[model samples]
Each structure stands twice: as C-alpha cells, then as structure tokens.
Target chain A: MAVTLKEVAERAGVSRSAVSRTYTDGASVSPKTRKKVEKAAKELGYSPNALASSLTTGRTKLIGLISNNFHNPLFLEVFDLFTRRLQEKGLRPLLVNLTDETDPENSLRMLKQYSVDGVIVASSTLSPEFAKAFHDAKIPVVHSFGRFASAPDVHVVGVDNVECGRMAARTLLARGYKHIGFLGGPKGATSTIDRRAGFMEVMGQAKGIKVKESNAAAYSFEAGRTAMLKELKGTHAEAYFCGDDVMSIGALSAINSSGLSAPTDIGIIGLNDMEMAKWENIDLTTIRQPIKQIVDSSVELVMAALEDSNRHPEARLFSCQVIERGTLRPL
Target chain B: MAVTLKEVAERAGVSRSAVSRTYTDGASVSPKTRKKVEKAAKELGYSPNALASSLTTGRTKLIGLISNNFHNPLFLEVFDLFTRRLQEKGLRPLLVNLTDETDPENSLRMLKQYSVDGVIVASSTLSPEFAKAFHDAKIPVVHSFGRFASAPDVHVVGVDNVECGRMAARTLLARGYKHIGFLGGPKGATSTIDRRAGFMEVMGQAKGIKVKESNAAAYSFEAGRTAMLKELKGTHAEAYFCGDDVMSIGALSAINSSGLSAPTDIGIIGLNDMEMAKWENIDLTTIRQPIKQIVDSSVELVMAALEDSNRHPEARLFSCQVIERGTLRPL
Candidate 1:
C-alpha cells in the first residue's frame, strides 16, 4: 500500500508531467509547482523510484566501488570516505568485493549487468588492468590507490609509492640507522614493488649502510608477524620500514613477543597512518597518505567521466608525510 | 563502440527475443539456440545491461547494505562477508554509510530512490526503528547485529548482547576480579543498554563485588581511549569488560600510558573478538560474537523476505563465548 505518483499529482492539483518534472533533476518545473508537488508528495509519502525514472534519463546514479583488500584496516577509512563523498553527491555506492576474484572479465561482466554509471576501483593491490577492463567495457572507471603512470590509460588517483619508498629509506638513514631493512607487503602488489624499488634506490646510494628486504604474504598483521619472526631469527636490522600500518603493527607484535621493544632495541616505521597507528599501545611512527583527498578526487574524476565518456584519462597524485609517534627512535 | 543485442542475434541467426531471453535468468530458451547465442555474444563482446532489463523484470537485484560504524574494525569483516555472499548470488550490494546520518526519513528516501530489492541494516548501534521504517515502506529488510526480540518487527539476526554481558561479568569474577567496571558503547545503543543490563544483573547477584559503569561516546578506539583516560584520573577498577574489542584496545592503550599493564595492574575483557583482538601486541581477551553466522543468517532472511514479502518476520540468535587471551588475569 504505497502512495502512487498519480495520487500525489491529484492531491497537489498538478499534472502528472509537472509532478515528474518537479522530482527529476535538471528537468524544467516552476518553483511554485515544484513546492506544491513536494508538499503533496511528502504528505502522501511518495518517493519517486529512481530505477523507473532511469529509463527516461538513462542514468542510474549508481557508482560501483570495487575493492579486494578488506583485511587491511586502512580500507575502513577508504570505505568511509568513499561512501560519504558519494552520498554527498546524491550518488549511491554499489560496493563490489573482489576478495577472491582474479579475472577482470568476470568483474567487468558483473558490473555491466548492474549498469553502474561509473566505477571506483579502490585497491593498491589490484592491477591497473582491472580498471582498464572497465574502461574497455565502455564504463567510466577511476582507479583509487592505483599505480601512477607518465601517460595513464585510466583515471588514476593515489600517492607515488616509489617516492614514498625512497622517503622511507632516507628517513631511516637520517635517523642514524646504519643497519636498515624493508618489510613489505605481498610480493605481487604493485605498491610493494614500487615501494621496494624506491627503498633500494636510496639505500644503494648510501655507504657503510647494510640493507635487507623481505615481504609479508599479505598486508595483514598475521603476515607481518610471521615475516618479522623469521627476520628476527637471523641478524635483524637496527630499524625497519614496514609497508603499511597493519603490517607495522604485526611486526611490532613480533618484536614485543621476542622481548624486544621499539625505538630501544629496534625502530619501525609504517605507511598509511590509519587510526590504529595513533593508538597509545601501537603508537606507530608512519607515513600518512591523504586518504580523504584521494577518495574525493576519485569520485570527482569518475563523475566527470560519466558526464563525458570521451574525457582523456589522467593521474591525480597527492603527497605523503611522516607522522611522528612512539615507534621511531629519537635522533 | 558497444556491441548491440541485434548484432549478436544476427550473428547467431536467432531472433533478438531469443538473445534477450538467453541473458534473463530462468527465461525459457532452447539449449541449441542458447549455445549459439552465448557463442556469438562472447565473440561480439555483448553484455546485457541490467538497468535496461530491469524495465521488463522490475528487479534490479541490488540490495542496500547499510552500516553506521565504519571505524569499528568488526565492520570490515562484516562488509567483506556481505559483499562476497551477495556477489555469489549475482546480487549487487549498494553500500549505504549512515555514519553521519541521523534522520531515518532521509535514508529511507535515498534507498527508495534506488529501488533496491531489499535493505540489510548491518549495525548494532542503529535503532530498531530504522529497519522497521524500511519494512513499513514494503522493502524487504533484515537487521544484522541487531538486538534479538522474541517477536521481531523485521527479520533480526545476531547474538543476545545481554547474555554476552553476563558471560563477560562471569568470566571476570572467575578470574578473581572483585572491583570491576563496565565500559559500554554509546548510551542510546540497544547493544550497550542490553549489555549493561546483563552485566549489572550478574554483578547485583554477587555480594561484595563492587561494579562501576561508564560509556564511551562510540565503539571506536579514540572514544574508548578518551573514556578510559577520564576514568583513570580517579581510582580505576581491578578490571573492565569493554563493550567491544576496539574499545578494549583503546582502554588498554590508556592503561599502558598510565604506567599500568593489563592482567597485572589492571584487567580488561572485550566483546566482539575482531581480527585485531587476536593480534599478539593486542592479545585482548574478548567475547566472540559469531559475526559470520549473524551475517549469513541476515543474508538468508533478507533473500527469503525478497522472495516472499509476506513471510513472517523472525529473530535468529547466536551465542557468544569468551576467548581466552592475554588481557585478563588468570584464575
């Protein structure tokens, strides 16, 4: 027993077309008629069905937000920001979890069936080809936290992981850590590859500094702990730069379990200063990625592409900075 | 640049209706024709648009997955499971973030506009009325992590928070903690209220066991830390049963910052054994709320409701158990 638009139109003493126009965005309707239609609609508890009207406008106002890394705590912030920004724009976020998905063809087919107006692929681990597949399927797509390219094939928004790597390496060296190591996330992730490259680039130039590198199976606490435990078995470095905050916390747990404390026996730094990084017990000194800005820009880019499918693809990069906390040793 | 249905039909030497029926679920078509249509569609890169087909079927197959607590790590798992399950059913999840939302009218209106087949309210903090509103609007609704009722207004699936509270209190008493405290979530949340009721109920029965009660503004690390810091200014309890694991971790941080340690200087037990609770560095003893069971049941209820909107609403409840970890003192 839902109220119908016809009843609302009859109650408002307006034509059905007028009532439809009043509710349709960018449709022509007088202010007085719009007010009358809105009042009647509210009184009758009538909500215009977006799906029914999408046939006329050919826009569903639904954006597919695809991601694969739910285990990473950093995604909590990413999902929050993406949903909020999309809601602000009156667009609904259709969350697509690719946790076990590898083939872009299946994802592309599924998203196509949903007829999502655009897509925001929010994952660092997902390859660029994933976003490219959506674009090739005639869907507007933006890859948030995707790799940067000199000439991008799709709309990309994220930080320079390579620069972040070099920065982490230099930060450790400047802190007088002669023996340093890079504790990275999964070896397959582009983020891990780029960050590792930058770390080695800077470490290779330094003299009298020994560097070691290894990767966690995933960007998770358990993986970090497992990888760090193996490193501790051998000659551990004076300091280490973990790939991300979750991994850093995991590595920290491994250190504490071995009766060693941070900044005293060993120092550690992480990336993506997630909320957990500031917790007093896990006060990890880390690099802060502009998550909110990146998400907002990704939404904006997708919306723009939706309006004009022919728009050239571009990369929007944000800067990352170090957040000083309890994990890093004093100079 | 997209292949049309007519092109695929022509290539397969079949009628366009046959091609369309081939894409529609459960639509009748000959097997030989289906094979030919599928082969041609694959070669022509033809994908049927879900939005366009919704005009005929009146089903978008989009379910609204609404949540309010993005900061709580438990939601990460909830979202992951919900999305994966929905995808398996060929249903899309439209994520509705009610983190900043206070008005039910606005949220209900937004969901209606999308014409979602159903709505799943996956939050313990949101009021029951939120789900009722959707049901009242004739939208199939399921409440996950919601309070259990003997007669539910809508489909309800989760653990009995009151029983969990009692479980925590008994665990603490068993560990010889005489001076105990209840660190709850927001004051208005049903989970917090029920948990407090059960905790106080158990403590009231036991003599000579002093119990203090306080609430964090939300089930978040910062809120938990802030509340604990305030409590620490005065005489603190021998142990605390936090409303959730994230808050427990926050309280643990506050205790550590005050030169105190858990299980020795102070004891802490949390509810919802989130992934972080098991982290070695934050080995939080917590009550494990069966998140997977709750989510799976919620999905089942919502899907059932969708198939038969007239189905009687029911409440499904799961039991909670204490997971022994490092946060609480030994017996």
Candidate 2:
C-alpha cells in the first residue's frame, strides 16, 4: 500500500489542490502550507509518482540516452557525465544500448511509447539520421559526439574529428618521422571517414613524406591489434595514428609483441585521451576530446528544446589538443 | 501532434475497448479485431503511451539500474550486459549513476518517484543495506556482484569473494611464493573484508609462509598503483593478490616504475578477470568472475520477484577460477 496525495492533504489539513501545487515544479505555494504538506508527505512516506504526474504535465522528465559503443572505455566516462549532469537537471536517463540494433525507427518507437521529454543520441558512430528520427517524430533530440556541420538537422555537440586527424598527422610529421601511417576505426563510420580525410589532407601536401592508411574492423583493441599485426607483416610505417585511445592501446600491444617498443622502434598516437590513456603503463599520447563539455552542452541544448520545441538546430563543436605522454616521439 | 488511441479506433471502425485491449498485455481480443487495430494504429502513427497505460496497469516497465563505480572498467561490461538483457525483455533501464552519492535513502526516494517495476543494484563495493533499502520500500531488487549471504535480505547474485580470495592465495602458494600479500579494495567494502578473511585463513594455516596485508583506497588503477608503490618502499612480499584486475594492472605499473617486473622480481594476481586483464600489454593473471552469468541471473531473479512479490529472498553464488596469464609465476 502506498500513500496518496489526498491522504497527505487530509493529514496536512490542506486542500488537495494545495498539496498538488506543492509538488508541481514552478508552481506557486505559500511557505506555511508547503511546509505542512511536505511534513505530512514525509510522515506518510509519500512520493508523487512521476509517471502519474507526467500524464497531467505531459513531461515525463525522462531523456532517452542512446549510445552504440559500450566496448570503448571512453563511453564509461561519457555515461558517468551524462547521467550525473542529467540527474543534476532533475532528468532521468533511459539508457538505450544500440550495440546490437542499428535501426533508428525501432528506438524512436520505443522512446515514443515511454513519451520521453527528449532524446540524446550519444554516439559518434551512429549516423546523424538516427537523431533526426527523434526530431521527425516530434521529440527534442541532441547528438553528442556527433559529426559537425555548418547547418544541422538536429542539435549536435562534439569535437571536430577531421581537425583531430590533421592534428595527429602534423604531430607525427613534426616528430621527424619520414614515413607515417593512419590506422582508423571501422571503414564505414563517420568518425573514421572524417579523420582519415583530415589525415590524408595533411600528409598528402607534405614534401617527401610517405603515408599509408588502413582501417580496423571496429574501434576496439582487438581490431586495432589485428590490423596492426597485418601491417607489421608488410613493412609498417615509422609511426601510426591509430584511431582512438582503445585502438591505440591495441596497436601498441601488437608492436610490443613484435619485439618493438613505442618511440624506439615505432611511434603511436591516439585520440580521445580517455582515462586509460594516461595509465602509468599505457602512457599513450592522445588528442583530448573535451567529453565533459560536449555532454554538458548536449544536455543544455536538449533542455532548451524541451522548453521551446521550435528552437533552431545548431552544431556546437569543441576543439581537441594533443596530450603528450610516452607513446609519441619528442619533436 | 501525436496520434491517439481514440483516433486509431475511429479510423479502424472499432470500439475504443477493442483498441485498448489489443495493446494491453494478456488482454483478450479477437484475432480479426487485433489485426484491424494494429493496421489502423500503424497507419495513424499511434503508439500507446506506456506511462498513460501505467495508470491502469500500475506497471511502468522501468527498472532502476543503480551502480556506484563507473570508474571501474568491469562495470562497462556490466552495464552493457544489463542494458541489452533488460531491453531484450522489453524493459527500459533507468540508469542511476551513484558514482558520487552514497546515501541509499536518496536513491530509494528517487526510484519510488519513478515507480520502477524493479531495481538492480550492481556493485560489489556498495553496502548490503543499500539493496535492503529498496526491499524495505516494497521494491523488488537483485544485487549483482554483491557479497554472498545464506539468508539474504534481498535477491543476491554474484560470486563468493571469500572463496575467490582463498583461490588466489592457493594459486600463489602453488607457484612457490613464500612471502605473500593481500592488497584489497577499500577497507570498508564487504568484498574487501570477505576476501581478506579468506586470504588470511589460507595463509594463516600454511606454516612458515609470511603474509602481509594492505588495502587500496578503491578498486581502481591509481589506488592500486599508489598502494603498491607504498609497499615497494619497504621489504615487499614476493608476490601479491591485488583486489581486482584493474588494481593488479596498477600494481604492475608501480613495479615497472620501481625498476622491477612481475614473475621476475615480484609476482601478482588479480580478481574479476576484466577485459583489460587479458590485453597483450597487461596479460595479468586473474580470477574469473563470470559477469554475464551473474547479470543474467540477477535479471531473472528481479523479473521473478516482479511477478510474485511475496517470493522469498534468495542468494545465487557462482564459482570463480584462476585464469593463468603472465603476471604470476608458473607452478
């Protein structure tokens, strides 16, 4: 048995409307009456059901947080920040794991059933259309760690992967490595494609520089290791920019197994300076994607859209910088 | 504007009761009427609101998935398995990140507000009373990776940390390590306490075997490294069974920085056999805690409790085994 608002009102000696107003957000209630209602509610162990109140307010305060990559350690930080920030804003995250399913229609339908106030597609690998599906369904949506565009169909918050790639290339070249390589993530992923373009763009213009490029099956350690093993078999470059931090760790493992060490026999750099990248053992030099800022900005945009659904869509991109460690050779 | 069930009923030329029955689980509706309602609903773009229907059924199909340690990588796998498994069962995971908060009262109040159908407390470090709070509030709960109790206050699913500790001690003894140590997690965690008891029990019985014991601040890499670095300052044990894999990797890092290496100047073993433990760069010897099986069983127990709220509390413990790798010396 649970306590009801009417029972709390009776115990507090207040009208039902007063009790309801005390619980509703942004509703006016006098201090004396609100204190009485809160005391009675606490005594009766009554918590207004969010779902029941949502029927009246049409705001469930539930945000559909969708992500496709769970294997990447970076996402753990992503999830931590998103959940905490959303919680701080009095919103709950309905975590939707898209690791297996790819169709946006199914997710949109599920979110619609729950009547979530908005959706945050928190994945770089997921296409922009995935976030658009929510928008088309009349749901406020923001894509975190998504691709940047001058004009966007939905609110986008993330880093410039293309610039990150160019920066990685330039970092390697500045280290005086005549032959450099790019080890990207999955071939079809937008992040991989964009980063590869930037890497090629910089390396192609360099004089007397030899460059090689390849992609791993996924942005995973095993995939990077597997791809690197193949590269080692056929004259690998002097150094490589291996996708994200996880993949770079995998590539470093492959190099170590091949009787080679970073900055001695070969050099490696990664993106997304995740926590593991700075491990005393891994000590991976990486491009730091401002994950906290991206997640916070995404939450802000979604909250704004919730207040006014007609807000124009925009892309907010944060810059990345090289976090020098042990993996890269000194310039 | 969103479509409504009444519109779908009107479009299908069926009674409103027929449309509602078609969507309600286990509600009887004729095959022809169900087909008509489904087709009309699809055409009208009507998705039955779960929160609205909860008013009638009193079930929201939302599960509060709570955890305290997001920094530990093992939890990434835990979250992935829990989210996917909960989704397969048509339940949405309301992820509660308690990385900062520790008060069970706050979480209990929050979950009650959401009216979650059930709760899953997935953490070894969290106190047992945390799960008990949910049970006290008449919320069905299952604690994954929790300490084992023959008479659990709630459904508990995980390994016996004490036995795991014994196994780790025996494994080290078999490797001919004379001086051994137990570097546990936080001193207050039940996992750390039970694991220490088991480790001391075995080591205490072995005559002429020296045993040293300490604890990391938390089950994290930095804590492990810091604790191990402190140990290395004095006459360190010949080998150590760190709290978990992440800590073991940290201890290894400390040893490397100290100009010592595993299985040569020292030995190390860990628990949880997390993904990173098997990385080629790490190759940490560890005890395997079957994470998938634990998560699946926890879900099952919580679901079963949802169906029969009067069900008696039960504890399901899985056995853990040593996964031999490069960290420990050979037998």
Candidate 3:
C-alpha cells in the first residue's frame, strides 16, 4: 500500500543501492544521485522502512526504556528528559512499564523479541537484578537512577544516594532538630537501603541526638502518608528527612491534618526536588538530584555501548545539593 | 548472535512451521507439538521476534503511543494506564514524545518507518489535526483526552469538556460565588474553548452574577501559577473554574502566596482529578475525567481499528464528577 524503495529508485533513474545508500547513515552516495533519490522519495512520499533496514544492519534503533515507578511525579521530568535525549540522537524509546513485574526473564524475552538495540532500566526502586539479567542476555543495558555500586555489574547513572542521605541528616541537625526521623521508600529497594545507611551513619555519631527510622511500602504518595501516619500515631520526631519529594509532600499532608504546621511543629525535608516541590502549595525543602545530567549521561553511555557492547561497566554518580524552602526552620 | 527458530525446530524434531505456529496466537498446533516446541525454545533460549514475523504477518503489534504533555503530573496516570493496558493485550507501546514537535509529517513518517500497527494520540493540548493527518495516512489512530466531535475526524475517547465546565460553574455558584472566573489552559486547545464556552453558557444566564475569562500558556503548574498571578494583578472574580488540576494547583499557589484562603477569599475548581489532586497536601477540589476508562477505551478502539481499518470514527465521552476537597469554599 505504501511506496517502495524500488519505485523511488526507478523514478530517480538511480541504482537501488544508490537509494539505500542515500538514506543510510554514514553510507556513501554521490551528491547527484542522493539529490535524485531525495526528490523521488519526496515526490512519492516514501520513508525508508527502519524495520526492514534493521534486518540488514542488525540494529533496530529501539531503546527499551524500562521503568517501574510511573506514579512518581519525578518521572514526568525523567521521561521527558530521556525521550528528548534519545530522540535527539535519532533513537526511539520503547517504553517498558515493569510496574509490579518481578520476573526478569519475561521482560528480557519481550524486549529481545522486539529487537531493541539497547535497554535503559530507569528506576531506583527496581532491583539491579533486572539490569544484570539484560546484560547477561547480551543486550546493552544502562541502569539510570540505579544505586551506586563500588564494583558495578552494569552501567549505572544516578546521584550518590548515600551522600544525599548524609546531606539531609546534616541539614536537619544544623537546624537544631534534636530528634530526627528517616522516612524512606520501600525497605527492599537499594535506594532506600543506601539512603538509610547514610542517614544512620551521620546520626550514629552525633552526640545526644536521637534518631528514628520508618519506611513506606513503595515510593508513592499514599505509601508515604501511611508510613508517616503510623509514625505520628505515637511519638514523632522534631524533623523528618523524607527519602524523596513525593514522600515529603505526603508527610507534610499528614502534619497538616494533625493540626500542626511545618518548620514549627515538625520540620520536613525531601530529596529529588521534583517540580511539585516548588509548587507554592507545597513549598518543600528538598535536595536536588541532577536528573538531566543523569539522563544525558545514560544516553551517551548507551550510545557508546551500542558502538562497543564490550565496554567496561562503570558507575556515573552526581552530587546532590540541599534546596531549602518553607519546610524547614531557618538556621 | 541470538538463537534462531530453525535451531529450536531442529532440536524439537518439528517443522519450522510448527514452531512458528506454536508461538503465533490463535494458530493451530497439537499439544504434543506445542510442548516439544516450548521445551526446545526454553533450552535454546529462542524467542519469536515480532519484527521478523511482521514481514509475513504484516503486523508489528507495536502501537505508537504519542503524547506531548510530559510535564503535567496528570500524564503520569495517563501513561501508566496506557502502557499497562497496551502490555496487557500483548502489545508493546512505542512511546513517541512530541514535546516541541509541531510537524505531523515528521512524526507520521517516523511511526510509519517503524511500522507500528496503530497510533494513539494521547494529548488534549495537541491539535486534532495530528490525529486527522495520521488517519489520512491510513494509520489507525485514536485520540485520548481529545476534543469531542459529533462527526469526529478520528476516534476520540475522553470527557465532554463543555459539560465539565458547566459542572464547575454550577458548583461554584451553588456555593454562592457571585463573581466567577474561567482560568483555562492554552486558548487554542479544544478543551479550553469548550470548557470556557460551557462556563460562560451557565454564567451568562445567572442573574446578577459576573464572569470573566483568562487562559494559561499550558496545562502546567508554572503556567497556571503565572496566569493566575497575572489575573490577581487586576480586579479578579470571586471564584475560578480552572480548566485542569495542574493549572488549578498553580492558581491555588498564587492565592496562597497572596495571603488569601480558598472559599473565604476565592473559590477554585479544577478538572482531571489526577492523583496529586487527591494528595493530602493538595487535596484539590476537581472534576474527575476518568483517565483510566478513557485510556482503556482508546486502546480498545485502536485494537479494533487494527482488525477493521475501515471502522467509522466515534466519540466516546465520559461524564465528569466534582470531588469535594479543601480547595473550594463549602456551601
């Protein structure tokens, strides 16, 4: 039903190989022949079939952009950056929502079936095992927002969550919050474990400072609210450094409902500094994770891997900065 | 190198056709033959490639899930639903981000290049012409969260924005907001036009009630806040029916920053009761747009269109319901 390359070549009076070379990246073709082919292609409104050409080139140009936490507002930024970056490089994102998907074999098989050139598993909550599985299957995979690994098994791009944890703890302690709480995402996620580790590491040394810890079932608004509500049921800390902004917002809501105001009754701090954190209604004090840098680096690494799949796996970590807002008392 | 189907077939002691049929949906194959094929496939780590079969079947099972609004939190829910629903049907979502993309030809050519089975235009802000262009190109297209049309150029699955506007107006008036305003999304968007028309239609008849209109640049937090801040610079109405929740949240932020409270100072209502609207912190009073149903219906329509490309375009409109929360002044 659609115009074929053969027809375009015939109309252009050029060889079929000339037409193919005209559209193929880095393929050599005479300028005169390219002009003729382009005119004919435009006249016939023919687009080079990427899937058909992928069979010959053995490259689909499809990146399986896998993510599990679609509910997080931060994903709005993450996906936007990832897609735009991927597209700028002439690559398309095949969004794989592994939300509630545990088995890596099925997802690996599915992505392989689609013949995606590479996979970018972009989630902190999702286990590193998924990345390892894809890598073992011989698919080029980059884990964005993945936990920092000393001896990395896969290409990882994200902030040093442990350092961000320490930053949050210091930000609270400096503000004179004697009793602090670490309200984190799911206890199972490496992000939660690392952040908790850093928070405990800092608080463990502070003299006369008491610390408490609680975790949400998932990195969701409802989960954060439920965990905070449970904590508020008995004794609550003077300040709580929520793992991320969404959870911090949830904790703020619980505090609001409890007839108390932030920075006065119970100070709050969050990480990620998502767009919502800046909303006037929820002016949350938070830490800024360089999402753009992480996504950009991830894309660059994947492109490099596409060229050299045997590239050594490395961890690309960024630093976090505290974004003070109305959630905390002035130091 | 990936394992080929021939290798699996040879190992299973079955014809290649039998192996292909075992993987193909609704294909005839004996249970014993299927068992042998499955075992060989497992042992050889062979997965049927969608692109390879698409050459013969002419179906890629790849749906182009196109969206332009990645900044809005509401899209988190929309994307989650669309990806999950598409996956449930054994179809993969080829996510196309049209952010900053205005030319339909480029996107059309790209989707065609990938040989997607169908396209779902999932943005109300994007022009209906995009959907129409894809349809003209003979691609099955369904526009979700799009404008309603008695004679739609393409299949549209969303709510009646006109009715939703009237609901907001009536809700605000019932609460005794004598002077109301319409803080809509981009003026060019069909949602903004229909919503404003409905609001004006009801307000035009209300005796002794004054009404005004304003528009945000986009349905985003910053845009809404900026538009509302501009609105507050002059003589503003007693209440506003913001076109969507993100904009309403922006308006709420502006109102709060001005030291005015909702209901007492000004009443505000929003559409698309997104997850953030229900957050304990935001607790926005909004009209539910039933995003899940719209997405589900849109996927079903696209799948049906794949089966029968000649299917006539239809408009599937869902009713909106106002969710009572802390944003608005109670009657």
Candidate 4:
C-alpha cells in the first residue's frame, strides 16, 4: 500500500495540516515542522498525490500538449523541447495526438477530462478554430508553431510564415532564377497560404519573374517527392522553395531519381531547418525558425496563464533567418 | 461559469445519480433517463469530469509513456503509434521525456505524483533499472523495445537483439564479405550488447571471416558519423552491421565524405527499418523490428496490468527480418 500523508504527519510529530502545507507550494508552514515533514516523507517514500492535492489547490500541473502532425520528423525536436522545458518547471505534459481528428470537440473533451491546467496546441496545419475552441471552453491555451495573426484570440508563439516565404523568394531571385515555384504543404493550411501570399507578393514586384505555386498533400517526404515528380513532368521551375525540410529532402530525392540534381537542374530552399537538414548527406539551404526559443516562450506563457487565467492573450513572433547549406545555388 | 452536473441533473428532470449513471461507462441507467440526460448534457455543453470520476473509480486513465531518445527519428513513429493506440482505447498519454534524466527515482516520483494508471517505457537504451523502478513503485509498466529475457522481472515487448545481430552477420557473409564489423550504439546499452553478442556468435562459426566491433557514443547521426570517421582513419571492415538505421545513414554519410561509397568501398546494414530507411535518398538495408506490433503489444500489456495488477510479468518477443534495400550490394 502507498504511504499516506497521515503516516508522515504522525511520524514527524506534526499536525496533518502542517504536512499538507509543507508539500503545497507557497503554503505557509514553520521551518521546523517543514523539515520534519520532509524527512518523514522521504523516509516513508511518500510522494504528494497531485490529484488529491489538486482537489484542495484547484491546480493539477498537467498541461495538454496537442499536435496533429506526428509523421513529420520535425515534431520530434518540438516534443523534446516542450517536454524538457515543462518537466524543468515541474509541469507534466499530457500529449494528445490528433492524427485523424477533424473535430476539436473530442480534444477539448479529453483535455477537460484530464483537468489540464493549460494547453499548448503545437501544430501549423490545425485551423485557428481548434485553438479558439479551447479558448471558448475557457481553457488557458497557447498555440506553438501556429500561424501569425494581427489579432489572435489566444496566445500565439511562432515565426511569420509570410516573411519566411518572402525570404525564400528573395534568396531564389538573388541566385538569378527567373522561373521559381512554391511547393508548399497542405493547400488549406494557414502557414502554406500565408507563405504563398508573401512569395507571390515579392515575385509580382520583379518583372519577368514567373512564379507558380503548388502544394503537397501533407508535410512529408513521400508527398513532397510525389508533388515534385508531378511538377518535373510539366513545366519545372529553375528554383523551388519547398514547404519544409522534409519536403525539400523529398524534392531532392525526386530530382535525383529523374537523373537531375539540385543547384544544377534545379535549386531548392526549405523552412524550419530541422536537424536532418544539416546532415552532410542532405545539407539543405533553408530558413531557420527559432524552434527552441518558440518552445521555451510557449512554455513560459502557459505557466504564466496557469498562474493568472485572466492574463491577456499575446502574440510572440520570433524572427527566422536563412541558413545557407548545399541545396540552393550560390548567389 | 462552467455548467455543473447538478444543473444538468435538474434540467434533465432526473435524479443526480441517474444523470451520473448515464455518463459513467458500464453503469446501469434506464434508456429514457439516459436519453434525457444526454439531451440536457448536450444543451448545457456538459462534459463528464474524468478526475472527479477517477476519485470514485480509482482509475485516472492516464498512462505514462516514457522515452529517453528524442533525437532518433525512429521515435517519431513510435510516439505516433503509441499515442494513437492509447487514444483509441480512451486512455490519456502522459509523455515523460527522460532525455537528460539519469536517475530513476525522479521519474518514479513524478509518475507517482501524477497518479498514472500505468507506464510504458519505450526505449532500448534506457537501463532495465528504469522500468524496474516503476514496477517496484507498484505501477503497471510495459517496457517496449526493451531487452528480453527468458525470465523478465517486468513485462517486456520487443525484438530479440541477439538474434538480429546473428542475422546481420549471416547476411554479410552470404554476400561474400570477408571482413565485417559491428558498429553499435552505446556500449552500456542492452541492445548494443545483445546485438554484438549475436554477431560475434555467428562470426565465430564462419571460417576466414574477420570481424571487428566498435560503438558510437549514442544512437544519433552525429555520434555514428564521429564513430565511423574514427574507423575510416584506421583499417576499416569490408562491410559493417550498424546498430540502427540512423547510425547506418551516418556511416554512409561519413563514407561519402571520405570519397568512398557503399557497396564499392564498403557495404553497410542496419537494424530498425524505420520510415527514413526507405527514403530514396537513404535507402538503407535494415532489419525490420516491427515497431507497430511492439508498441501495440506494449499498450495491450499495460492495459491488461491496469485491469489486473497481479498479472504475471512476461516477455513478448517479436521476429525481425532483413529489409533488402540499396545499402547492401546485390547478392
């Protein structure tokens, strides 16, 4: 049987209330009683039950980490960073994988059932409605790697996809590629739409620079390869800014399979600059989104919300820069 | 204000117990009352509180999914499968990232505080002590991708690493590779030790087959690359059986960087035919560990343990087979 708080209190020669206060954060208790309670608890191998204590404090310290794109390897980094940072702050991450989920109701129900103190919707493809649903439920939520909006109803932390698209376009133009294309992620994704907007806006300014935009079914290597293969069969661009690193790697594979090579037959740039992009074999030139910073800030925001649910929603945008490698041609 | 169960009961024109029974799984409730309760719940946007019910049922429905290696791309697939399967069973996944964690006590304390129904230690590199700690704490646990023994102290679901190593050796020998090597992960890892043992056992039987063994710091691309670079500086083997796919890919990169190529200068094979192994760019010949099966079985085992804490600890070993790809020379 698990050791109880009563046993620790009795062993420490202190009141049950003192034992509870010692375990409760910011709860006042005499130092002598606290030291005795701690020693007794340690000896009895007793861990304060978060559930039992939550009934009193109204805080579970459980954060719902919701995501949809598990197939993408980039999320591995995101998950790692989020979990580590949350763990450091003594907050537990309850991961909710929304792989086939289209309705946000299911996720909202699950989070509510789990009694999560807050939630971090870590996905770019998921519609803003998903985040708004959590807000409507009055749950503290922060969207990580979410689309940038002039006015966000919920906490938003990520890079500007539009600016990333503009950077990709400018990088391709400087490389002297008159014909360029935007191979993006899912067509309906806000990130893809915003990126395409920025890319087209820049290309339209430069006369004689014809740009075509297309999208992969998903942000995966297979989808990227298939989309690039289809593009190769038709009018191919001299340079292409693939949606993300995974897609860029896929595009490179498709080009190689067709007896064509990057930077010679075609130039490519990617976003996110995932760890795999830096592999000597891949060496992809891409836009580096500050993934670590975004994750840290998101965790911080969620913690702040936990402390004050009335905390006003804020949008924290991190700047992304070009990371030159081997995928794109030299300017 | 959030809608209360009391309000839902009053609106449904049914007793509070009747309304509670309607929401409770397997609880007895009349059809007419159930319909009325459901209607009232929908109208009030009332979702059952899992925590409040958990206090009565003594089941939190939260399973701690623990992992140490987020750097390995293979984990993306593992996490995806585990989370999907857990959610399908109406269980919540509390992800415990032990990337930098060395002490099992910390994890045990955290899981205890969370009051998780069970835990799934999904790692090959983490020591047996990690899973044993959970078991000792009276928590139901299934170690997925863990080392299997005839008499396991804790429930284990994974492939036999030793047999996999023997298969790799036989494969390399059949392909007429005289000098072979074992490029494994960390020396302290159970997978690495077991795989090396099997590889040496098979190599011992074959005459005129020279074998050397080395290990990477960890099962990461950078570690593998660094290990292989050191090997290339000296007399390397004609072929190598890497610890895993990521390591194999790293070795391939190192060989290419040194102006050497696989199947010509050297051949390579790896274990865990992860999604990336099939990428046209990597195309690694590897041993498929049946990750989906292991993850599914792990979830099943943990769920069963939750139902019956007295369930006997058993080892569920799955078969691994060689996935022929472009890494190895055609026989």
Best by TM-score: 2
**What is the C-alpha lDDT profile of model 2 across B1-331, one tens digit per residue?**
5788889999999999999999877999989999999999989899998888887788889999999889999999999999999999999999999988989888888899889999999999999999999999999999989989999998999999999989999999999999999999999999999999999999988889999999999999999999999999999999999999989999999999999999799999999988988989899999999999999999999999999998899999999989999988899
lDDT of 1 by residue, B1-59 (tens): 45678999999999999999998768999999999999999899888877777656767
Cα lDDT of model 1 by residue, A41-120, tens digit: 98988998787777667788889899998999899889999999999998989898999989988888877776778999
Off by over 4 Å in 4: none
- DockQ, in order, for the candidates? 0.84, 0.91, 0.85, 0.84
The per-residue C-alpha lDDT of model 2 at residue A125 equals 89
Report lDDT (Cα) of residue A217, candidate 4: 94
Q: Which 10 consecutive residues of model 1 chain B have the lowest summed lDDT?
A: B49-58
TM-score of 3: 0.97
Clashing pairs in 4: none
Least well predicted 10-residue stretch by lDDT in candidate 2 chain B: B51-60
> TM-scores, in order shown?
0.97, 0.98, 0.97, 0.98
Model 1 regions lying over 4 Å from their true place: A1-15, A30-36, B1-7, B10-13
The C-alpha local distance difference test score for the whole of candidate 4 amounts to: 0.92
RMSD to the true structure for each prediction, in A, is 1.8, 1.2, 1.5, 1.4
**Correct interface contacts retained, every candidate:** 0.96, 0.88, 0.89, 0.82
Write candidate 2's Cα lDDT for A239-276 as tens digits: 99998999999999999999999979899999999999
